[model samples]
Target: MFFSQLINLKEDDSSMQFIIITHDAEIFDDSSVENIYKFESAPDGTIVSRL
Candidate 1:
């Protein structure tokens, strides 16, 4: 509910931007998301991926 509200608020206000960090990808199932960054941990360090 809160998550959806955030999206709605962002849509209503063009100047608004939300930064969400979530483990579930279902929230990003919509076409509204322009960019997605995934993080993975390795033995050496952390790796970042753009999907």
Candidate 2:
């Protein structure tokens, strides 16, 4: 519900920027998202990648 509202808000106001950290992949399913970063724990250390 919150995500849906956020998406609508973004559409209404183009200037709004949101940085969201979520475990649910459904958030990334939105077509509005152009860039996605994934953080994962590796044996050596934490790794960040663009998806």
Candidate 3:
């Protein structure tokens, strides 16, 4: 299962851009996502979080 969110950013010149946040590891590691950032979380309990 995966979760995702989209965010909008506005610039001083009134230009708008979009940002995407997701839990997909493959998408994060893909070369096409060179300009994107990735974050990882630690296990909170007995379950280990992947990607």
Candidate 4:
């Protein structure tokens, strides 16, 4: 599985990190995801909200 592969890669290098952007709400269901954020653009400027 993709998550399992990611786990292996992280174990091989403890300092590794990743920036994965996806529309799938399933990603948020994973416990390993330490942080979550939403990004959007508006007439004023770009806005980011931490979920």
Candidate 5:
């Protein structure tokens, strides 16, 4: 999953942070992130998913 926010440069002096939760540890393999979460899943290919 991905999370992002828009901030006004004229109002905020610091950058925004986001939180993400995922069942796979490999999701961050070739990506950079601010945070991460991991969990196990069933092998049937469909065990509850979200966009």
Candidate 6:
């Protein structure tokens, strides 16, 4: 509910920008969000990639 509210607020306010860190793929189920950065574990360290 709260997550949906945040999206609604962003839509209502054009200047609003949000950076959400979530493991839920549902966040990407909508087109309201643009740009995605994924992080995963690696043997040496962490790997960051743009998805």
Best by TM-score: 4
Cα lDDT tens digits, model 3, 1-51, are 122222133224563344666666566563344355545555763434333
What is the per-residue lDDT of model 6 for residues 1-51, given as tens digits with 9 covering 90 to 100? 666676676635566566778898676876666778888999999999988
Tell me the alpha-carbon RMSD of every candidate.
Answer: 3.3, 3.6, 8.3, 2.3, 8.0, 3.5
Residue-level lDDT for 30 in candidate 3: 37
CA deviation > 4 Å runs, candidate 5: 1-14, 34-51
lDDT of 1 by residue, 1-51 (tens): 665676675635555556778898788886477788898999999998998
For candidate 2, the TM-score is 0.55
Weakest lDDT window of 10 consecutive positions for candidate 3: 1-10
lDDT against the true structure, per candidate, is 0.75, 0.75, 0.46, 0.74, 0.53, 0.75
lDDT, model 6, position 14: 62
In model 3, pairs of residues that clash are: none
TM-score (C-alpha, index-matched) for candidate 1? 0.60
Model 4 residue 6 CA deviation in Å: 3.0
Better of 3 and 5 by TM-score: 5
Tell me model 2's lDDT, rounded to 2 decimals.
0.75
Query: Model 6: residues >4 Å from true position, as ranges?
Result: 1-14
Output the lDDT of residue 33, model 2: 74
Error of 6 at 43 (Å): 1.8
Q: How many clashes (backbone atoms < 3 Å, residues ≥3 apart in a chain or on different chains) does model 1 have?
A: 0
Candidate 5 residue pairs in clash (backbone atoms < 3 Å): none
Poorest lDDT segment (10 consecutive residues) of candidate 2:
9-18
Residues forming the 10-long window of minimal summed lDDT in candidate 6: 9-18
